[model samples]
Target: MSMQDTLDTASRKLLERAAPGRVDFENLVVVPLFAVVAALILGALTMLATSVEPATIGRSYLALLQGSVGSLAAISETLTAAAPLILAGLGLALGFRAGLFNIGAEGQILMGGMAAVICGFSFSHLPFAVLMPLCVISGGAAGAFYASIAGWLRAATGAHEVITTIMLNMISYRLVDYMLRLPWVQRPGRADPISQSVPPNAELPALLQWLDPNLRLHAGIFLTLLAVVVVYWLLFRTKLGFEFRASGASPEAARYAGMRASLIIVLAMATAGMLAGLAGANQVLGVLGRASPGFSAGIGFDAIAVALLGRSHPVGVLFAGLLFGALEAGGRQMQVDAGVSIDLIGIIQALIIVFIAAPLLVRALFPWGFRRPDSGDGRS
Candidate 1:
């Protein structure tokens, strides 16, 4: 071919590669789906190896499925569990998109929850509409402020976020413990670490109490869904998101483009912290109704896995959170109904992560799974 023709062909290929919606479908969708399947298969094998009878194994799996989605109560539990995970995972995913590893969500969640709970009990006389929003805003703002400390440290002192956030987590735990022990913060007449119960008006209203008062599902799920939408828009439809993506992809190039690195780092961390704080607030206001030691329930740590499983995408985080929530809700049923250990669910989750991390291994096992018939580049 002539030199001009060769240049034109190269330009067309570059444009095609850069076009929107051109993400690799196999890696994005198929890999994760198959990883789940693989994990389930391995979990079943684990049961057999542990001397579980084949029939009992089948029953355990059946109970798991039923408990997650078979009945109204099951669906409610799944949604209730999913709401917090989705919120926290969205925060972590946002950090991932900005090339930052924010591991202090545990501290942020604790701070946020405590802030909301304090708001809840202190303003018991306020109307629901006024008090609820006030508590939520306080939770988010507290989390943002606490997280910004780490961000500012990283920006100004050249400190690594991983180290700073971990230290913050430890500090937060002690700080929360101290707060809960104070005479004014602790529940009156109770010596335990628990805070006073939030007023009824401050609680997140149950979404399905009229249909079944036993359901724990609440309006927080709607907020979680709204956060998903907002994060999606923030990541894909905003100029700030472009800067974040650019910085993550190539810090040198972003700097050359005149984007302020320190500002982006601090803002990204603050945004992630805000979401995490909201998750904590949701738990306190929507479910727990108070703050205590471990009130965050390690949701912050689980959020890392959720963000990874979701490939750091907002929509993906939503679905991944729901799946993890189903596993949690169903694991209880499996244990109660079939006498299976709840640890089995943990094994499955670990296996899924392993498979997801090793896509080449999955592709090797299913060589034809991701190949396109007409495309010779070896991807669908």
Candidate 2:
């Protein structure tokens, strides 16, 4: 089978397994949980092999737990980090369901954020009620239009989304840099490729600032939650979503069923782009308050792993995003409190993804925990 066909099969299986009374329990919950545990255990082993002291290792782990959930401050940090991740991951998850590997979220984030920043500052006179929504809408629209380029290419010229999206990512990096240099966008007296601050009225209101002004958690979390519900409804309830799934399952069959394959491809890509754009807005409007070089900070790329661990399901993505967020928040404390290298967190994350992708290896390592997917009995 072709690569697209293979991807479609994988996506279909993922969707099937996500359903009630399906393989969802094994693949979605059990496997991801074990993958995380195994990665952590291996991370400890790596520390031991590196001659790190056992006391230090224990302290590092303790610090990690404390930083992630020990207090309200840590929870705020984790939620702040997770907002953009969950937004971006949901978009990518939608694309995956449609058999589109649109990895250009980084680019989409950049362009969308730039657009929202422009809207925020340009319409500074508008009230917060109007301006905030305007900035968000502009961001989503920009992302959708940007992503549609690859979708259009695929529909019109048979260009693969993987190649096109990667190329778009490269182009977007330079494009943002160029835009930042424009006098209108550039901050006064700043030679660096950074933008002027977005207007205060356009910023997403801090959710926890009433309790602590330093809290980064913002109303963006609400937006992220809303997107999750919308995506769930779209993918499982709407006829358009069925069409998207149908196309992914078998393009030929979808065409035979009279679905507009070209339109579906473009719409799917554009929809994913919109979500990514919203993520960009969440970053700029809720957190950064402006644009800069590499402002997205690889959130787009990391979201790919989030989507994978979530099994491309909206609810799954939510939990996965939060888990990754906790890891990030905890990793910082691990470094500061225990003087452990933050790189260990990266190693653990990589190992988790490796284990997630290779479930058979995890099953082999812990045979008692998992049943074979095809087995009716408990035996593998």
Candidate 3:
């Protein structure tokens, strides 16, 4: 064979190795696991660099494990934290799959919480069945509306979602702050800028309150699971989902194939906002029972990492959310038991994202693990 022919064959092989049409089981499982391990190893090294004792580093990790799942109560706390992350991550994943970047989930969450609080306090006489659904619906609608503003701009005015959504996030912060201080929304007797508590009927019932009233785990867990299943079905088993995927993969081709790109963009963003709004409702109705400034606690922002680490897959997002939840729940324990700064957890999370984003680096770090079994010679 000519040298040029050999070079062409080598290039084709390299391309095949680097970019598979679909992720194989090995890549799906091994890549994320390896990235997490690499992050942990680097995190340990970072601790050592900061003058933390080796033994203390070990104890901090152990405390993290115990805090996340050591006991039934710890497991419950992990799940509680995971619930909002999963819901919001799923929303962001949906937008990603539709070729849209929605950085406005934080604002949507705030709007949803504000709407739910307003509904909850205004209809104090409604029955549980009526009040609960009303609050949830209001929250979702409010979120959808808020997110649609950015989507409409993207579709109609050619504005980029990243810039628009980021601006929207800042707007939401100021908007919520103003709303909380209003005479009708604020607590009746207190001057604090907090909303009135949700009525009992409007609150989500704790699933395990019978075991212990202090357990904050609630029916929102079931809602989050249901959302995962629904998103999966929507993405893989429907015509609209096919359109979303096609548009994401190639907008020009989807347009040539007669897909309405504008409609899909708006619809996808609206759907994403609705899911994020539900997350806000879950926080307020299921946990806090009222709206306060900064109640979102950066769940919307962390959800971006969750979506990326999950590779925009619904099932992947669910597991990633759980993992992050465990880290968050354990960080407190590590701080208390091992005298380590909780900021270490943030560093680990950042490292994980960096590794996941650099697949080539991960592959280079674990060559033996990523190596594919050779087929018969001359097969190609």
Report the number of clashing residue pairs per model.
0, 0, 0
TM-score of each: 0.93, 0.93, 0.93
Better of 1 and 2 by lDDT: 2
Number of the predicted model whose lDDT against the real structure is largest: 2
- Residue lDDT tens for model 1, 263-338: 9999999999999999999999999998989999889988888899899999889989999999999989999999
Give one digit per residue, the lDDT tens place, for model 2 in 1-380.
99977876776566555554546577889889999999999999999999999999999999999999989999999999998889999999999999898899999998899999999999999999999999999999999999999999999999999999999999999999999999999999999999999999999999888898988899999999999999999999999999988988888999999999999999999999999999999999999999999998999898999999999999999999999999999999999999999999989988998999998888888877865443333222
List the candidate 2 regions with Cα displacement exceeding 4 Å.
Answer: 1-22, 372-380
Query: Residue 350 CA error for candidate 1 (Å)?
Result: 1.4
Q: Alpha-carbon error at 361 in model 2, in Å? A: 1.5
Local distance difference test values of all predictions, in order:
0.90, 0.92, 0.89
Expressed as tens digits, the lDDT of each residue in 260-306 for candidate 3 is: 99999998999899989999998999999999998999999999999
> What TM-score would candidate 3 get against the native?
0.93
Residue 70: error of model 1 in Å?
0.9
